[model samples]
Target chain A: MRNIWTICRKELGGYFVSPIAYLLLTMFALIFGFFFWNILGYFVNEGMEMIMRGETVPMNLNEQIIRPLLSNVSVIGLFFIPMITMRLFAEEKRSGTIELLATSPIRDIEIILGKWLSAVILYSCLLLLTALNFGFLFLYGKPDWKPLLVGYLGLLLQGGLLLAVGTFISTLTKNQIIAGAATFGICLLLWVIEWVTGYESATWATVLAYFSVITHFDSFARGVIDSKDLVFYLTGIFLGLFATARSMESLRWRS
Target chain B: MRVLTCFLPPSAGTATVAGFDVLEQPREVKRRIGYLPETPPLYPEMATSEYLRFVGKLKGLSGGELEKRVDYVCERCFIADVKQKLLGKLSKGYRQRVGLAQAIIHNPEVLILDEPTAGLDPKQINETRDLIKSLAGDHTIVLSTHILPEVEQICEQVIIINKGKLVATDSVRNLQARTRGVESLQVEVAGRDGSLSYELVQRRLEQVPGVAHVLCRDPHEHRLIFEVQSQKGQLTRGDLARAVVESGWDLNELRAASMSLEEIFLELTGSDAPKETAELTKEMQA
Candidate 1:
């Protein structure tokens, strides 16, 4: 565990010192801000129309604004998660520091976990940026915080799942751009897997839909914490990290 | 080297480092060994001290012990002056020093350095070699390089590998002695006549006892250089000198020629015939 934390701290320190951290933070916040403004604008316009008709329409801020915003955050994460995870191993390999990590007295699993945890932490910080906008919503509107918390949890799980995959892809190449592109390609495939459900309702389609990240995230976005969804994300994280450890093992042998 | 360091497993053979089987007790082997690959593994963005501290932690050092070890290595490698500078900003020599510092940060019992002096100025190369020599007894260093002078200057035992095969493993002096069987003699003779013919000198030297072969290397009018090869284990320098003088030639110089490490390396690894001969000789001696 100490070894893992040491690696994690080094990785986190690496991200903070590089310009990628600042760039990702700024890009995420700006995109989330746009989503917040558009969502809130639609909600306000609907509320005003209801008031002009003198009808008392229930405006649940959590359902109307928070859920959609959190869902949008998950989509935005598809782009930024790749950026954060691309350098985990690829940059190390490119700079020849992978030799140091490989020959170190730490287990392969620890290195993978350390790098994955750093990416998760960075993604969490990006999610935290949107909380400033949420804080504004809470100040003026009567929004239930529990559902918002669940929504944020969903975003984290979703982002972590992609980050884990990205971490695996990073180990495949020394080129960061290639790693990032491969990660985005895999994430896009996972995202669009649910489209098979739209075309058919067969067993194959149902399985494909179940495999889609968006399917598991739907319950969390709607504030329903299903055990199955948690299991899915956990399984994906475990499988991704397991594959990464395997790749790292092969790399050790080849080196 | 990677297998000995437990970074890579051997395909067919076993390796042990610091009394730990690399295949079975990799963690123990890793704990006892520090490896520096051909290129230094470094994070350019990190300061010299910070990178060393990070590597120290990876090698399982922490707290005051880590600090003390880091300080010791920083001073040992003479990089304390630039410890605060980012590694990328540092000069190549300093970067190599930092690489060396990380390898010894844990004070591992074995140091496997691949080409430690490669790609350095003459002064830095000498300094690095001196630093390596200074750490000789405390650490069992496995220094790998194609530089023969480095082996002569630093290594006590040499292992020559070619085409991924171990060609020979022995002390440097032992290898040099093994290749010294075909003794050579450098004879510079001044003839009575201004001109010296190669045919006359070659025929005369070949008739000398213990002389196996003779070649007129340089045939000048007043001076001639003859390279005389003696039969295995034969002392021919004295016999050749006497033969030249008896032949009415002024013997200016006659000395036993020695083979250098480079020549021995070429003899062992340069061709298939000599390699087979060396292996046959090894078997015969065994």
Candidate 2:
């Protein structure tokens, strides 16, 4: 456990010092902020129009505002998570540092979990930076904290899922390009599969959508933290991380 | 970690390091056996001291223990000068020192350093060799290097492995003693019958007691060539010389053939003479 924390500290410290982390953070802020502004603007305009007709707004302002912002944050995470994760194992192997790491007493599971946790924390921090969006919504209207907390929970869940997938992808190759591309490809597939299955009426499609990380994220974005949705995201997180640990273990003996 | 006596199999029979079974207890075995591969894997972004501290921590050293070990290894490997420098900026020599320091960080019972002096200049190589020698009393170091002098100067026991097989394992003096007879012994004889004389010499030499077998020599018009191997504890050079004198042959050339570690290494590793062998011989004499 100490070994895991040591690895985590160094890996997280590395992200802090390197330009890659800052670059990804900037990209995450810009893309997420842009999507949040556009989505909130459209939703607010529609809500104001509805109010002008003398009918209660369809959704409360908090739901109208924070939901779109946090949901879009999850979407933006699909891109930035891989940027930080692609270097975890891939760059270590490429630069010959993997040998040093593998020969140490640290377990494979610890190493994978350490790097995964670092990515998750960095991704969460990026998400936290956009918290001012919720503060803005709270200032002008009555805001319910439940959905806001649910929305943040959903964002963390989605980030965890993406982090696991990205870490597993990073283990597949020493080339960062391949790691990045493979991570993006897997997350993009999960995203598209959820949308496609939603269109079809197949009962299995609903099950697939239920399992889709993006779909499970919707429950959280809507401000309701369902146990089943939480379970689905947790399953994704565990499966991805488990596979990464296995990959590292196999590699240690293979060569 | 205590090292038990064992052998590295397939290469030979059984092997153990610090009482741990390399095959059965690889983890425990690894704890005692500090291995530095041909290329030491280093995180270039890390400072030498930071990397060593991390390795020490992973090896389960306490904070204070880690600091002491790190400093000891650094000073022993002569890497203290660049402990604060990032690994990326270190020279090939310093990098090798860093490799050695990391390998010895835990003060393992045995050290296995493969080609430890590979890329270092003469000064660095001497410093490394001196360090390895200094550590001999307390640490059992298995230094694998193509440099024969490294073995001669540092290793008390030399195990020569060729083609994944143990060709010889003995003290340096004993191996040199065993191979020295065959390697030396200049036969001085003038022959007129040419091929017939060579065969006669071979047959006659084999007939001598304490003489193993005589290797046929290259055809020199006036001189016949043959290599003589003696039985254990018996040298027949005197008898052979007397035979040549009695046979009425003019003894033209006779010299004892002594081989250096470099020559022995090349011969054992299945390679011809290294280009630098000549310079090494000159250096050894100087």
Candidate 3:
């Protein structure tokens, strides 16, 4: 556990010491702020239209605005998670420091957890940035905080699953660009797997749709926390990290 | 070295470090050994002190113990001056010392350094060699380098591997003594009034007891150089010097040519193989 924290601290330090972390934070906040403004604007305009029409349907702020915003945040994460995870092992391999980690007394599982946790933490920080915009909704409107918390939890699980896959891809190559591209490709594939279910109803298409991360996150976006969705995210994370550990073992042999 | 350090498992055999089987007790083996690869495994963005602390903690050091070890290694490796500097901005020599510092920070029982002094300036090389020599008593160091002189200067026991086979493993002096029978004497003589020819000098040297062959090389107007080979299992330096003096030739210099590690390395590795060993030796020298 101590070894994992030590590795985690160093990995986090690696992200912050370079301009990459700051650049990522700024870009993510800007994009999320835009999404927040657009969503809130659409929600207010719809409310005014309903009032002018004398409709008695009450609009729930959580569902009308926050849910769509949370969904958009997940979409934005598809672009940023790759950047967060691209350097986890790829930079170490390129700089030859992977040898130090490999030859150390630390276990392979510890190293993977350390690196993956760091990425998850950075992704959490990016989510926290979106919270500043959410703060406005809480001040003037009676937005329930519990569902917002649930949405954030959902974002974390989905981001963590993708980060694990990125971490695995990072171990496969020393080139960060290649790692980033491959991670993006894999994440995009996971995101779009649900598309297959629309065109066909075969068992394979159903399986692919089940595997899609968006399918699992849909319940959380609607303020629903099902145990099955939790299991899916945890299983994906476990498989990704397990594959990374196996790759690390092979790397030990090859080196 | 990789197997012994537990970085790679052996394919066919078992290995141990500090009494821990590398394959069976890898954690114990890792706990006991410090490894520095051919290139220093460093994160350039990290401050030197921070990096050392990270490595120390990874090796299970923490709090005051980790701080103390980090400071001790920094002072030992002469990297205290660059403790706060970013590793990427430091010079190569400093970076190498930082690499050494990190390896020893945990105070492991064994240190495995691969080509530690390669590509360093002469001064840095000497300092690193001296540092390694200073570290010998407390720590068991396994240094792998292509530089022959480095082994002769630093290592007490030498292991020479050729084409992935162990060619020789013994003390440096013992290896040199084993090759002593092939020793020759190089003699530079000023002839009487420049009257001697190459054949005359060669014939006189060959006449000496235990002298098997003599070859006159680089004939000059006033001096003659002859390389004299001793008979197998015989010492010929004293006899050849006396023989040259008695023959009325002015012996300016006569010394037994000791076999260098390079020559021995070639002799052992060259005979069994073809041109690859020669190329490898040349590469090592470069």
Best prediction by lDDT: 3
Sorted on lDDT, best first, the list reads: 3, 1, 2
Regions of model 2 farther than 4 Å from truth: A43-59, A139-141, B1-15, B183-257, B262-286
Best by TM-score: 3
Model 2 lDDT tens row, A184-234: 888877777777564697888776666567888888888988998888889
DockQ for all candidate structures vs. native:
0.69, 0.28, 0.81
Tens-digit lDDT track of model 1 for B170-192: 88889888888777878887778
User: Candidate 3 on A1-255: residue-level lDDT in tens?
Assistant: 888888888988988999988999999999998988888888889988999999979789898888988999998999998899999999989988988998899999999999999999999999999999999988999989988899999999999999999999999999999999999998899899899988899999998799889888988988899999999999999999999999999997787
lDDT of 3 by residue, B1-286 (tens): 7888787889877888889899899999999888888889989899999999998988888899989998899889999999999999998888889999988988888888888898999999999888888888778888887788787888788777776677887777888889766667789987778777878878887787777778777875456888888755685567777887888888999877678887788787876675343322111110
Question: What's the TM for chain B in candidate 2?
Answer: 0.64
The runs of at least 3 residues in candidate 1 whose Cα sits more than 4 Å from the true structure, single-residue gaps closed, are B185-214, B218-256, B270-286
Scanning candidate 3 chain B in windows of ten residues, the lowest lDDT window is B277-286
Model 2 scores a C-alpha lDDT of 0.74
Judged by DockQ, which candidate is best?
Answer: 3
Chain A TM-score compared with the true chain A, each model in order = 0.98, 0.91, 0.97
